[model samples]
Target: MKKVCWPYFDPEFDSLSERIYGPTCRVCIDNESLEDCTVVKVDSLNKQGLLLEVVQVLTDMNLIISKGYISSDAGWFMDVFHVKDADGNKLADQRVINYIQQAIGTTRDPPKPKAYTTGKPLEPEPHSERTTIEMTGTDRPGLFSEISAALADLHCNVVEAHAWSHNARLACVAYISDQSTDTPIEDHHRLAAIEDRLTTVLRATTSSATAGGNCTNQQQREAKSGGGGGTMTNVERRLHQLMLSVRDFDRPLAMMEVASEEGGKASVLIESCREKGYSIVTVQCRDRPRLMFDTVCTLTDMQYVIFHASVDSHDGYAFQEYFIRHVDGCALNTEGEKERVVKCLEAAIERRVCEGVRLELSAKQRVGLLSDITRVLRENGLAVVRADVATHGGKAVNAFYVRDISGNDVDMEFVESMRREMGPIDLAVRNEKSLMPPNTADHQRPRFSISDILKSKIERFSHNFVAIK
Candidate 1:
């Protein structure tokens, strides 16, 4: 038999994780029968955003974390969370417990060499200009919160926002639109009002060149960053933005001033490189809870493996870039395939937001019931990717991920067919109802900074769009 090296097979592997973060970690989950909840426990070396990672895992599983307790001593962290699944039932499945542990507790894979870029590309703002408001002044705690409140008072909704602080200095940039119009504020008086209120809250007491002044209409474009330069710091700020506005995932009042919000919108770009055998997709949209998870799941169900990703959320907008190849290692070599990918993504995102939940069903545990349900979906050109089916007290409660056979969204007509075929089956589906507060924190690699994102964008443009004359 051929032997394979497991991660913990050698002593050196443990040392590597200890050197970088802290120590190899262990995670576990079990059902609390009395309370009817799941208890997720984590023991890991301390790292930045560690708790956030745990929460993200629970969120991804369609589970609600009702409460948590965590403690860190020296470099080790011990945490516990009580959670419930989407159906408000206690987690009884042992497989689900293992899945949670693997998601939040597993060691990160070692980094790999990237497709190195040799020079800086002319990084341009990919979207049309909107009102960009900047503020710089004395650094103070809660500066971001105060500024956000001020903007809210003026009925301005941020599309994207970034804040950086250093050695007692703070800088912030926000692209916003008045909630009334979803367009950039055109009234000079209203713009001045917003500027004045933000300045007061930021507490730039002494008016001077370095003391910080407000700039309008220019995003931090070329503006020197005061203190933040670390890649993780920038991502932390994006996560902060996500945490702040996850439940408030509303688009600006209207479309981008320069283009339509169609599949081929200005901020949504899809390109493929045959030479590299991968596809690159860049998307700019409103940030919301579970939005990124849903997006990744859609791609996975479509049989794509993401090789690289860069995600940023600011003001009120989110920018996501994914480098991927088909699960079978095929590039999106044809224009029709590329277009289908973009259109499908757009539709999936919209459906997730509009419908609020995917498919959930409950049926009698009988011979071939699950098979017959799957056959119904298959006959209607739908495929099921992820599913949780278990019989509790003689009833089968199941959750399923359904998509189109051609990697597009399941059609509404087909959905109705599913509903009819699933008749007599108590499909206790959950529809998205109320908005919950957004919880944000993330870490993934190979992480990219703003510059890296730009260069990649330019490369895709040169490779996929440009032509030799």
Candidate 2:
């Protein structure tokens, strides 16, 4: 029988007594009873980062909940969300409901009886020449992720490829095959969908300069007519646009898989650990879509505060070093906890779906890229708080502080998932903490680093180092 198993930490996780292998409580999204809001009820055995996972799922689904109630006791949790879809309408999609169920560690599909079989491996499917996925777009951080994600959504499995960038332009060509059939993609509609998704992402990559103008006339008409959903005045809209340029987003992370030529594996080493203190986490993994984001997200979900991060990617692997402490300012001393973290990170980086705030890109300084990024955020039920855009040797390095349109922090467990969790309620704070220093007991200012000094000098010397558009 083919068997699947969740990553296990120790005897407890592997034991039936722990209920990790027991019948899981069914997860459900109850919408029929509510008129204005959907009720998402999740009942499951509690696990680390379980709460944040729920939030991430809800946020990714573009659901807005006016209120929520949570109760947990004796290794079990029951969370309810009074929610509505991104369009401010009732949530009724069975597919979405099923997704939520599966995401929260519950399943509605009837369990298939185990199949008896010989232990011999099945014969492999025939191989073929690969369909190629090629991309030429703005070069920036997380750029590869956008391309890889588009391919993944089309169910195209990467076989091999070459990717590079020069002067803010990126070119990537991937040899790929259908994941299910292990053959070259022959479906024209699927090919078109892949191309269309890639194009949209590329547009987003270089879109800061071209966004918003086309919608301005329509927005003005709507504002004057008092019929559209927005309530911002024209002046407010202009100011909002201006603010977009000055905001510096956090550095986005991406991971991509390598072809056969490059052997790939993910590994983690936790050192300098003490009870109630800090640890140094080192992760080495194959680059996959959102690898950086997933790593950071997992750390945050586990309530770790990153005090320092050093990152580098070469060939086909990524190496990341992190100085971290728990949110309560404690160190992880248990092997089980550390193992859980390592496994969680592995799962996060390998995830292929574009659920929640997953896609990020770096691009050339297109005339309206910022405007476009902002517009896309609004359209996709995402909110951008802080951003940083700079040009380096004619190429732009930009970062964004973004969250799926969930407002307010759901306690400290989700600070990383929420990006600007500690900032003011509205996205109006001048000093952003999307990437703040490790949380300090007294909240003292972080000691200066070389880049900090250089950043200050650059701002002092360049009149437009961070000037608003």
Candidate 3:
């Protein structure tokens, strides 16, 4: 009859023990319940040949196996397996013991870490090493694309990125890697240059001449509304209309409308924009109402236009007559516009899903509260988008739109841990319509990677053997 074995180090015992020892004994001595253990070992001719060798041994022994894990630490390679022996015993065997000894003897020495040199450029790895670049400043459009283009020019690949805009400012983090290693020092120098270029780009993009031009018209309207106290309601109505128009557009666009006489109205517009996936820009109209258009321009590749109009009582029957004109033509939509919009929306939704936390702070029940939840979500690698905060009877209620979570990636244990950390919170995980699994109708044989199969088998044996103990 065939059997399975595992070799694991026990620091406390100062020796290697049969993870599965005797045919009718506990594999893990600490666990008394397990019994009927058996150990087996296999030999590999080459260090890299361990995977194939283990497969052959298992086949020869007629053992059934599943999952496994391999770890290398402290000058030793450890392979843990889960399997069942032949004779339908579902127990460990001696073959596992021999395999463990062979694996250890044949294990290769760990590779030495390479040092970065100044004169001689290092050879680039097949896969680029990931690094992050962070930018913070007054928010402006086109910032994202300008930085992306600069990285691209430097032969740097952007693997992942994130940007957030709030209170008239923006911050972003981009994961990038350099593809060329002809000169490592030169590549580092290029990164520095890119940083400098980024600063310049931000300055140019956020300048008053470029972004300021779009809000001139709104500023004038606000000034006029303030001058005519009776027209406050009319001005608010018009601003709301503009916001609705922008939101209703096929593409996402941020909107900011300011009127000095009706500051509350401006706040309402800003809140509405946030719900619609648009970054709210602050409008400060001291003399003439001015809207500061500051969003990641490159990501959206859009331009801003300011339209100013003066309405006279005689020109309009009962309301003021206003003139409308574009300050500048911003790029509207480009190639791949639909796909980009969908991706942005999907990302936004995922951020909301991952960032959501249950909150119970008051007598009344609340769904989502983001104040402390946002930080927690960020720590757990979640991005938040739309956050709704409401209060009923002195209790806070909150809901959020998030990015980067799906059922496939959800870990139940992690979710439970999060629940324990956050006091009395409810979680609503959203299903993404765009992410559907492929159909596997055909009964094609599942091709397993040699290493993967070996690992699986070892895990099966280890788990069963431990259970017996």
Candidate closest to the true structure, highest TM-score: 2
lDDT for every model?
0.50, 0.46, 0.32
Candidates in order: C-alpha RMSD to true structure: 27.0, 21.8, 31.7
- Give the better candidate number (1 or 3) by lDDT: 1
- Clash pairs (backbone) in predicted model 1: 158-316, 159-316, 159-317, 160-314, 160-315, 160-316, 161-314, 161-315, 182-253
Against the true structure, candidate 2 reaches a TM-score of 0.29
- Candidate 3, which segments miss by more than 4 Å at Cα? 1-128, 181-188, 209-469
TM-score, every prediction: 0.28, 0.29, 0.22
Residue-wise C-alpha lDDT for candidate 2, range 1-469, written one tens digit per residue: 9999988677655447437545565577777888877788877766545554565556544455444555444567666766666566776666666666666654345322111112112221122355655454444445555555556666766544334332233344445667787567777777777777776676563344223122122111110000111111111222222222121111122222211122333578898845425688888865432345456566765577665455555544567776676778677778987876675555445322121122223445333333444444444444433233333343334444444444432122232232332222111112222111134232353421222333443444343232211
> Against the true structure, whose lDDT is highest?
1
lDDT order of candidates, best first?
1, 2, 3
Residues 301-367 of candidate 3: C-alpha lDDT, one tens digit per residue = 2222212112111211111111111123322233354343333322222221222222222223222
Candidate 3 versus truth, CA RMSD in Å, comes to 31.7
Residue 439 Cα positional deviation in candidate 2, in Å, after optimal superposition: 32
Total clashing pairs for each candidate: 9, 28, 66
Name the candidate, 1 or 2, with the larger lDDT value. Answer: 1
How high is the lDDT of residue 441 in model 2?
Answer: 37
